[model samples]
Target: MQIEIVEVLDQERAMVAFNSPVGSAAGVWKGGQGLETGTHHVEFEIPDEVHSWSLVQPTHGAITGGGARGGDFVTVHGQVEGVGEDSVVTLRIGPDVIFVEMEDSVERLNQGDYVTFNSPTVEIYPYQT
Candidate 1:
């Protein structure tokens, strides 16, 4: 998905925002070279293990701040894309697929399950192609 790098937080991090078919979301930059403020095609990765998540009624997918963990944490709402044997769960969030590492086993998730959870970090990487 394409996102605007709204603010640079540090050498390797920035604040990113995007609007899509599912909804709008703003999250902290994760992986990638230091970027200038502009629009870029990127992929999102949740580096921290998501300890809490649950199936929810189908709703608009979004990434927002103010997670219960607080301090740069983010909340993500989306549908489960797939559960890998290695515990990495793919999430479909508003026209984008984000790879998330789950803290717990992903056995409970099924394809297309709508879910939401909080994570300490949401990383965005510049993508070419």
Candidate 2:
């Protein structure tokens, strides 16, 4: 997994992007039709008081018999590095920390900021390469 700091929105908000090499293509196709290709963008907004954050990947559901069917869930963990003079902090996703820096700003963000990371349609196709 690789983490890239795309931009920092403020002391409390930052734009972080995540990319992981796809190890397999067993389920790369959606509805067993189209190819999936794209990097998953995960953004984080650290509160003024929070030094670290841990979030779980949201679940997807399918409708069956007029009801909803739920999918599996995964948990993702992250830590906070102190804000730098550039107002940007880069942290790695795996056990070892590799840094990537991006732009920074001071604008406030709402729930929309978090939703970007939880987008289910975003896909990555490794077999194409």
Over 4 Å off, model 1: 11-34, 66-71
For 1-129, candidate 1 gives per-residue lDDT tens digits of 877655454543455554434444556665556556777777777877788888899977787763222345677899998998778898888888888888665798999899999777666677677
Worst 10 residues of 2 by lDDT: 61-70
What 10-residue stretch in candidate 1 is worst by lDDT? Answer: 64-73
The CA-based lDDT of model 1 is what? 0.71
**Reference-based TM-score of each model:** 0.76, 0.22
* Backbone clashes in model 2, listed as residue pairs: 8-103, 8-105, 9-105
Candidate 2 segments whose C-alpha is farther than 4 A from its true place: 1-77, 106-129
lDDT of 2 by residue, 32-85 (tens): 232123443322222222222333343221111100112221122223333344
Cα error, residue 39 of model 1, in Å, equals 0.6
Model 1 residue 70 distance off true place after TM-score fit, in angstroms: 8.8
